[model samples]
Target: MGLVRLVVILIIAWLIYSTTRRWLASLDQKWDQKKSGRSEKIETMVSCAYCGLHVPQNEALQAQGKYYCSSEHQKRAESS
Candidate 1:
């Protein structure tokens, strides 16, 4: 009888441990997804026509329908 009780207790303990581990793992995965989702935006990248350097479109300078990394590049492109 004592042996049976010990076996049952060990089974219960293992079940509880496994359940807790799975729950914690799921929580961790959800946190990672939430954290990554914050910066998961697709930005439009444009290349500077003068030097072929790529930059995010929102931060690039636009002149004559061409993208530039800086004003100097834009002026040089316009001159050339």
Candidate 2:
């Protein structure tokens, strides 16, 4: 009886370990794919027309075909 109990416990442990390992591996793979996709995205760097500061195109404000680092700069340029 004691041997049977030990066997059952070992089987349960193995099953838990296997499932946990597979789940963690899947999570790792998903994270790696996400990271790779992000790295592959087109990164555009543009200089702010107002201050000549370099910033990522995606975050810069675009107006009149010019990129600005902030809305304040854009408004300042437009007002001037």
Candidate 3:
């Protein structure tokens, strides 16, 4: 009876350990998938026409066929 109780406890412990290991493995796999799935492309860079500062083209302010680092610079350039 004592041996049977020990065997049951061991089985229960093994089940818990295996379940936790599987859950952690799945979480790790999901994290890798999320990182790889992003696959973000490199953005083109443009220089600010006013200050010659480099910024990503998508983030730069464009006016009169020129790119500026900020709106203030763009406004100043346009006003002049």
Candidate 4:
């Protein structure tokens, strides 16, 4: 009877440990996704016409059907 109780206790302990490990792994995965910016909404990326550098569309200056990464690039493009 004592051996059976010990075995049951061991099983319970193993189950608890396994559950905790899985929970921790799930939390780690969520944390990694947040830290890596995977949890954020995807933005459209556009390339600068003058410099050929890629930037997010919302941050880029749009003019004349062209995108520029900065106002300076846009001015340069307009001048040239």
Best by TM-score: 2
Evaluate model 3: give its lDDT. Answer: 0.89
Winner on TM-score between 2 and 3 is: 2
Q: Clashes in model 4: which pairs?
A: none
Q: Can you rank all candidates by lDDT, best first?
A: 2, 1, 4, 3
TM-score computed on alpha carbons, candidate 4: 0.53
Residue runs of model 1 more than 4 Å from their true location after superposition: 41-80
| Clashing residue pairs, backbone N/CA/C < 3 A, model 2 | none
- TM of each candidate vs. truth: 0.50, 0.54, 0.49, 0.53
Candidate 1, residue 69: lDDT:
96
lDDT tens digits, residue span 15-56, model 4: 999999999999999999886784243457899999999988
Model 3 lDDT, residue 77, Cα:
88
**What are the per-residue Cα lDDT tens digits for candidate 1 across 1-80?**
99999999999999999999999999999999987765553347899999999987878999989999999999999998
Ranking by TM-score: 2, 4, 1, 3
RMSD of each: 5.5, 4.1, 4.9, 4.5
Model 1 poorest ten-residue lDDT run? 35-44
Error of 1 at 18 (Å): 0.5
Model 2 stretches with alpha carbons more than 4 Å out: 42-80
